[model samples]
Target: MAADRRVAEGLEHLKEAEKCMKTSFFKWKADYDGAASAYTKAGTCFKSAKSYDQARQAFLKAAECNVQNNVMFHAGKAYEQAGMMCKELNDLNRAAQLIEKAGHLYREHGVPDTAASTFDRVAKLLEPTNPQKAVDYYLIGSDITECEDRPRQAADFQKKAAKLLVRMGNYDRAVEVLKVEKKFQIEGENAPEVSRVTVELVLCHLARGDFVAADKAYKDAYGIPGFTESDHCRELAELLDAYDENDQDRLSSVAARPMFKFMDNDYAKLARGLQAPGGGEGGKKKKAALLDEGIEEGMEKGQLENQEVGGEDEDEFEGGLC
Candidate 1:
């Protein structure tokens, strides 16, 4: 429980800071820098008191003041702090939106990597409830990463986005994203990565019930030297053949063959649904659950892991306090 005295103290500090900021901005010859600094102090006090919602508001006000003062870099940095507070409060959607704003501001300030990272966070936050939005943000982030000359990191984000798209059953878009990755991967250098992407593409096609497309993807994947020899690859081939033959029993057997340890093999569930008594409603529910869980994993993992990259930058934020 929050201490009542601490909460009241925090609110008092916040109100006093707001009063000072207004006095500075409106009556003191528009001293925007002073107002921004006061707001940053208010945010610091709120954060120290564990009043995260108030801290977020204070930080956002600081950002607005910085923007008005033409200190765009500080504005972006202030928004980044506000986003962190929202994230801490479990208001992920609000955090993502603020982070996206920070990303654009950072990009405008010529901080490519920071901008890319902020966009990545936004994508991860949106992945579960709005995968399409996640994919869009990931694309933007990956392009920025590429521009920052971090091709491998860019490829990783693209692959992540593609996987989310596949989980969302947007196979066509997944294929497109993977194709972009393919263009970046050097032959014999990232060959395994390329092969993995191809495997994912084949699975996406199969999930979409495009047997011919799946077969084509499988064949294309095999054309890469040493690609079709893995036991996993062999199982994928058999699965494709079964799907092409319209043999539900064979498809079910092949899809359940334990080749996919990383992803849920929904093909087996789909086949079983066809063979079920009540028109596959149970299978449909399972498939939907699988999609939800997969996307949720991506979203939650990003928040858990990705936040560690630049945490040491807190000292810079400390310097902004009045």
Candidate 2:
């Protein structure tokens, strides 16, 4: 009676709006159940009167009255609220179960993918005690949708799974997971899926430490702007022809090959610490660092005056290892 009296007093001004909504709701009754809405309005009025528990109970009754009417959306929302209430009461397991009910209803309504992903959120609450179960949910999250509907969906979930697999040392499976992300299984031959798959395939190849395979993959990935700039591709390029900083003689001698420019390899700074001193690897590094700075400084002397040979072809360093 107290809750009802508060609701009545709070809604004294909006009785007409409430009736209009009730009628509108009835007119759309077949598509959406409008009968249980009385409790919803009463709950709103109770909430406005600061009677929170009473407001919550009214919403619960509204949900109960509608669940028999097949209004899955309202039932789902009820589960969500029940879970919220359970959380405030510090009943975590019951709270998790309530959220899970909403997740299940979401699946029942032609949105299995969204449901599976939603379940992942709840699964996280249980992951510390149940990681393998989390992995199971993660895999299911990947499988609930067609690769064609939201094509990147598979890749996104699979990539997450692959990280877990990496922790498990399932490298082969991880690569395979990456491969699945490369495809549009339902797409036609001329579709963009082919190009997208090619980029994904490149990432898989790079993971295996095969430079030749990576080179081919890089070619494909480079065609896609995001892939080309990715850390994975850049790291693979570094490993394919990693320079030996300890071998300065080889680095500076006539047979020494030119290396990637500093801008191209961000690690050029760290690699400096490993080089031969003075001339061999070490001297070449100092020389390189000095030249880098010299080139940057504003010089009073002209290029011709500064050149021992020319700015580009100065005598290479020879003896600074010790």
Candidate 3:
């Protein structure tokens, strides 16, 4: 009964807010500030009465009024509140959308930190049920932080996106995200992180059966200070060599190393799944092709040598005619 009474009171406030929006001879303005305030009160009352849908609608109205009043920060806050109400109603999709709108509003209001945080919240909310959407929000968060000159924060968000992609079995996209993360780490003078990301890039390439790309990723790390001496470089070298030699046993052994086990869960799983290229029929065919080419080249070289020897003998027999 008390909740119903609150609902009735909320409706009265809503009516008053609508009336405030009207213009008369005495008032040229639409009284947007008063409407926003009244709508905010209505939303709170509805929320307290456990009418989440009604609360969400009221908060969204409040946000619109705030926007019309040019109070962007308050508008963002109102949208955030609406998103919370959506969450309470188990409308996760709508919650994410509202929160994302709030984030954009915060960004447009010139509040970089708040905007980035809002984006991060939306990403987290979407991570469990909609990983792709989460990745999109994470990227948006990273871009915002990057533009604000927050390299470390940007790199952190990119790392999250990369790891999520790996878990989703999207290694190619993961590699691209990791590359961006590596660039950020390098620019930040974070050598250890750069080496770590390079190692991840190598593993991701390997996961996709791209041994050449994996080797190139390893070699590219040589430019990072101390990477050549780092354990990551050594691990990558051993892994690449095992793939090149088509040593399945050695590849498995290297992949089973403690370092690989200690990586993020997705990457750790990826490492465990790393197979030597020689293990497949395609690898066998490639190896056989290379061997045949090598034999053919060797036979051709031998024929050339014999011709040269015969010419020299013929010249000897000519008794220095020239």
Candidate 4:
């Protein structure tokens, strides 16, 4: 109760502080960075005080000050934060403009991967403005670029674009990205898009509990085109099938080509179950096998000694986190 009352009092003080800052130099100061720093601190205080609008305004002020001070990165970050706030309020166009500004600044500073990712983010915000254009920008980052220049980063962007495209009824492009991701020769990207690129792969890793390998495979797959049946995708599919047999593994198997290969290992066994001639029923059996195996394993030790098995219920299964 005391804490809540104190918070209320602090919020009143924050409003006074906001009034002071607004009256004071929401005016240019000689040292823009210093002024921006003050505004950022003010924003933090306002945020703590539960004054979202004031915090948003302070962050915007800080961004403008950063631009004035020639600190593009900080400016970009500030706008990104403000854009997030605006997005939370469903003010999409303003959010998009702010995010676009950030992307433009990142591009001006020669940060292609960051710029590319920023563009991807901004495009998402502007989906209502033009959905195709967002997808086009994502494709530019993912495809139409070579391994010699930001290939891995571009591939990542492509993956993100492909996902959104899939939602947009661009399945052909989505499949094309998955099919081509394995051909790039580059290793890792210094910066990555915050969208679907890494997420698709992360979902794969979760199925197998192989995070290390997942990261490597995703990076390798990003920039390469001919690597459609890449080891990463096949292995991920196989892993997912291990838990739930209902999945499409043929494409991954075909894609994992000369470069990276997913052998006839554990995943392979599951893949066989998932890809057999019987199709859906085969998948169901595989899922049953996994569940039975889990139950047996639990009964093997004192693991389930303190627990009781529940009533018989209809078993269900599905696969492919990616």
Candidate 4, residues 204-266: lDDT per residue as tens digits?
343344545545645554554534445455554454453343334442443243322343233
Model 1: per-residue lDDT, tens digit, 117-139?
Answer: 88888888778777888888998
User: Residue-wise lDDT of candidate 3 within 170-285, one digit each (tens)?
Assistant: 99999999999988988788988998898899999999999888888889889988888778888888888877877776777898998888988888889988887646344456
Candidate 2 lDDT by residue in tens digits, 1-322: 7766777764552343344344353465422244346656665677666665655565565566568678877777666665655555556676677777777787787667657667677656545655555556566666765433665565556555655554454446655765565552323232344343443343334334344664665565565545555654555345333322433454323122232223212122222322332334544665788898887664634555667466534334343443
Q: Give the Cα-based TM-score of candidate 2 against the true structure.
A: 0.43
> Which stretches in model 4 have alpha-carbon errors above 4 Å?
1-29, 116-137, 140-150, 171-322
Q: Which regions of candidate 1 fall more than 4 Å away from where they truly are?
A: 1-28, 87-91, 186-188, 223-225, 264-322
List per-prediction Cα lDDT, in the order shown: 0.74, 0.53, 0.91, 0.56
Q: Which stretches of candidate 2 lie over 4 Å from their true place?
A: 1-64, 87-93, 111-117, 123-130, 164-176, 184-234, 237-322
Please give the range of 10 consecutive residues that has the lowest summed lDDT in model 3. Answer: 277-286
Candidate 4: lDDT of 194? 24
Each model's Cα RMSD: 27.0, 14.4, 10.6, 19.6
lDDT of 1 at 60: 95
lDDT of 3 at 11: 95
TM-score of each: 0.71, 0.43, 0.80, 0.45
Which number leads on TM-score? Answer: 3
